[model samples]
Target: MTATPPHQHDVVIMGGGLAGLTLALQLKRRFADIDVVVLERRAHPVPHAAHKVGESSVEIGAHYFDTVLGLRPHMHGAQLRKFGFRFFFSEGRRDIDQVTEVGASRYLSVPSYQIDRGIFENYLGEEAARNGVRFVDSAMVRSLELAEDAHQPHRIEWSQEGKTHTVHARWLVDACGRAGMLKRKLGLAQANAHDCNAVWFRIGDRITIDDWSDDPAWRARCEPRARWLSTNHLVGAGYWVWLIPLASGSHSVGIVADPRLHPLDTMDTFDKAMQWFQTWQPRLYDELDGKRHLLQDFAFFRNFSYGCKQVFSGKRWALTGEAGLFLDPFYSPGSDFIAVGNTYITDLIAHDRAGHALEARAQLYDQIYHSFYESTLALYTDQYPLFGDPEVLPVKVIWDYTYYWGVLSQIFFQQRLTDMAVLGSLREELQDCQRLNFAVQDFLRAWSGVSRRRNRPVMLDQAALPWFAELNRSLNDRLDDEAFKARMRASAERLRALAMEILERARHDNPTLAAGELGTLLAEKPARLRSDAPSEAMLFEPG
Candidate 1:
């Protein structure tokens, strides 16, 4: 059955997820005269299940939504507040919880919010509607036809109630989440180099916390704190489970693992995943002993690519959010990246409408976005083994810098487009670091060799301290004033100096010193220096 064509609009956005909605809102705010229509396959008032995954929001993401998108009221109402992240790890007899306190912390320590995507998306949808975005629900877009000339308009053919319809617009946006609907239609199904997938479901009434304290004040403080029981059990092999709390008193529990270890076809899906959870994390299993019930079966996907090669091909179309770049959820970057993409795309669209050269601006945007995603992907994937290892001290240090970098980048640096350019250059250095594939096993072997003997010979002495201090001062002056950033950069410089000193001293003290050991020691420069330094100084030192 043929359906009538709707009136042409200035912009047509495909997919009604958070990314799509955000772009629509930004576009409306930027170009009020341009008509924007969003096509979503789901029905209005989308029925979203509780305890679905992705409940955590970083501080930067929240600020963008509240401040940039102008949705503070909606966010405040639906979002669950969170202080900076707390990482727990143990080394022999010592245990550490890395906590970044608000205000004193480098990143905006404003608590991030944990929100149910279902509830959050609904609110965003409504908010977009209020901003004059016309939503076409339960509308499945079949294909897109690009116009031959830049002046000609693009066309989208879609269906509803078994009938067909066509919509024309100057711009078409593909914000479809993971499905990559538009991307697939255009034959852009590039597999992510990293083979990772996740399976998640909601657990209701299966987990409960009870306070036994008799003191009223203690109980009052303990009860509320106890409610925040979201936990991540980091089992090795690129597998981890996340337990997040929702306002409905349910927990969002899921397992993210590499397909190589736990193939989807072999496991019983939910039952096997739950059984593994029960065996590995007994404490959580015990908590849910009498309280837990499964809400749904698991959902899985692999080849989660970092960025699309062609996010924006011309003035007529642009991709935003997951459609453009889908980074791993290891650090909860999904929402933040979406907000940033929307902001940039809309800003460019606004400029183009003002008779500016939007094509050139869009090309620049695509270049920066791709570079950012590639760098991020390389950074995480290369460090995958490091993060997977609970004992790697260097991993902890990198994470400390990462946490603060996210804060500083979002709050201060990301605001300036130029900063992103500088950041892009930094990523090039990181790419080189990743290509080395510094495995954990190699590091541990070297550490064992060095720390094994009790009477280990000192290669350098107090006499060399002057040179080290001088080198440190030189590097310190060049670093950003942030305590953490300066310390990290200085630490790197110290290692380089220490490596040279070690080789020079070894050559002078013992002419027969093995070249292999010197090479090994040199290779271990940065991490070795970081580990040997006093606990209070390095970024990764556990507090």
Candidate 2:
């Protein structure tokens, strides 16, 4: 090992990926005079080819970067600016399609953006440097030295340029994505043991966004098209393709499949993956149309899980981003989660610097953070069938209503408070929904009963209204029953109208909203949700 470096820092962050870099920037911003060092295994500004995956962001996540961290100005030059997500569920044009806007305003509430991951990370690195964080490239952290006292400072050993060095820090952060070097070294790493592995790459020239009309409202609001293609066709197994637009008119596309449905071993090399993509993703295959260039090489991973039980060990160590939790990317929450984690870490660091007792706060953060992932796991693992079922359509519709209300609530009411409370509430809701899980599962098993036999595509009708009304009544009790039903009717009408509006907006290429504009919608009370109602009360009941 090379000789130890002579200097020490207040914090040493491992891995220079999104989470690492964001925390580095946030820490320096909050504590300007503290010495912060970032160790990255790759050389400066890691060269990553543009890819189709890792393109979408959720509203809650975007708010942190744009408003909380104040990185919006820097992100203005990103390849794509997305208003919300547009989901399509089949290979050909005849599949189920839905669009959900993610922001706060009824007129201007689109929630997130899409961008090239490589470019975005590069921008973060530069921003971190500007904020006074020292980023050391080509240095891989091999192991950590726990302070002999176990409560004192810790030492980090890393290698670069064929030399080994040790550095001491009052605090350490692990932002290492996927590799989990620090996590493994600390013996905090654990397998998810549930999710399947996925492989992805980007194909350029074969894809284009011109076929997708720009929304004038979206254009005015600076919203870019972030398209995702899911599958209900082509053998009907679980797999998806995504086509996201970037700044330079380039597109990113990739496939995510269930290992049991589509094993990667069948496609061992980049060529095999491409061939599979051509066979499965017709639009992408047609777009490629003989193109020979690849923006990214093949990348794969096995079934992933979340939660690093010990994200922060005492006063001097913490984990952020993927190092802390690796939720399934079905929601496209990568950057958002990283940004949120960084914000929390910065808050803790600030508290420590102020000499307050932070152990309680740290523990609270871990639980809340764990709750977020746990809630996510529940949704993806247990509730995912809602997306593919018809008999459970009413439940899915109600859930969507709940989801939108929850998003609005967070932005308007919960923003000023701790996230733990919000997540804690959600955890309760998930537990309450556990009984409903079997109902949803049964619906999935008999999906063909309603879906396949239809002579014409069936859209949800007024029959779903009562269930939604009951749900609304159960969740909030301030409004009278009649008034609550009216509100549900209104919200449902609005959703239907919004669907048409989205189609028109897409056709005309218009952008309708801006960041931070959704506060208006939240100002109005949603359909009266009753505190004493079964669903609402069940959600808050003792677990």
Candidate 3:
């Protein structure tokens, strides 16, 4: 343990979880002369296999880890390359191929990973320290002394090895995750409308989902590569079960559901989760029944989604990761938020160090970050039931993926988080997209309400969709200011056309349905996919 003395640091970060460690590394990487200290309550070398629940990474998170932090070597070596997201709408039946599935036939150019949190986080902590960050483990923060004045440095008091130590910092960031030390103390927690819960556990042996089927054609769908490497989800109504493989010969099985549908008590415990699986996911239950004794750990959170009233402050304090806000794990956006939040925080710190106007920038970042949070929340708020409908869910997934890849992914990939000029130029377009998103979310709920659960044995290959695959691969392309703006404008138009498609589909299902903001837009300007562009009519049509 490092000796602590009322030390003065350029930045002091709390809770050395994924968010905290990553923030420290990012800060150190940008400003080498800056002294950063990270305080983690957990001891070093945390046990492998069952360290944490967020073991899956989507493209945003993976790119952040690989390109942003320049840790591709560690990611490729320590983590399992994700084989894209595979979903089984089989519900109860063990015949996976017989049930309708939504996934990629081949891996997309964009990369993600099935992260073993234990291994990944451990590496992050070590990497942070190795890269000139003072990462202190076995730390328990007892009190915080946040500076009220703009030019004052914040103060932190923590305990390590039964010794109380004090540190002063120009910036104090809360990356402590759910502990939310600053959030609780400052009363920044704001309850979101998205009330969902999750329960998950890891097993000692691998749960090879591919072996569940014996059909030669089924096995041949994705050949040579192992399906177990993919982050598999057995999706059903109001809940989805995730099967993530760990590098340490273990499988992470999780049940994330809407409490309104699947009561928390029904599957809070390991035994109850197993029994719940028996009813909804018999194959997984059957696999775990024999190895119940080898249960490594069990955890559950009721109403995990939340919003923060304030995270970025002009007072030289900020929050990142779960310490500030978290939307959902369905798309594995935890690490992505860390990347974004850290990016904004770093920009603010850079401006402050250079004695530029920070209050305006801070307020702008606050609005932008929270807006991103709200946009993401729209996808999940009261949208869990759609997970069960094989038909509607596939379309919803495509829409969601398009929105994700089109707008947000482009901003981050092109490194435009703090570009005020670009953001201002696209303000009207973004506002329209937001309104369209709200309308489409409501449409999806309404459509799912009236939709039928058709479980046809059709494999909707996301990679086969040329536009969709191109979107994934296009992230690597280098674009200039003009090209970037053009790309964003194109994405916005795509969303507008998509809104029209969703509206038509909704009206097709329910002739008496009324339109909202999107409806008005569609009324003024109809959603017209280009002649060569893919149309929704045949994508999810009766296959």
Query: Candidate 2, TM-score vs. the true structure?
Result: 0.71
Which pairs, if any, clash in model 3?
A: none
RMSD of 3: 1.9
Per residue, candidate 2 scores C-alpha lDDT tens digits across 1-543 of 236444677888998877787788777767779888998887765544452256666556666666666788756656455634333333333222222211211112433566666777788788888888888888978888766653477788888887888888877888877777667777787656346556666555325332433445432322232222211112223555555555544555555566666676755566676677566544445556466564545676666555576786546678887777777666676665676567667777777778777778888867655645554454455333333332233333334444444332232223422545444544433333332332333333334233431122322322234433343333333444344434434443333332322223222322332212122232332223344322321110010
Q: Candidates 1 and 3: which is better by TM-score?
A: 3
Tens digits of per-residue lDDT for model 3, 41-137 = 9998998999988999988888989998999998898889999888899678877779988888888899998888889889998898889999889
Ranking by lDDT: 3, 1, 2
Better structure of 1 and 2 per lDDT: 1
| Better model by TM-score: candidate 1 vs candidate 2 | 1
lDDT of 2 at 205: 37
Misplaced by over 4 Å in model 1 are 1-6, 86-108, 206-234, 265-268, 292-297, 382-388, 397-414, 418-536, 540-543
RMSD versus native structure for model 1: 8.7
Off by over 4 Å in 3: 1-5, 527-538
* Cα lDDT tens digits for candidate 1, 393-434: 233333223332432333233354434445454543333232
lDDT of 1: 0.55
What local lDDT score does residue 174 receive in model 3, on the 0 to 100 scale? 95
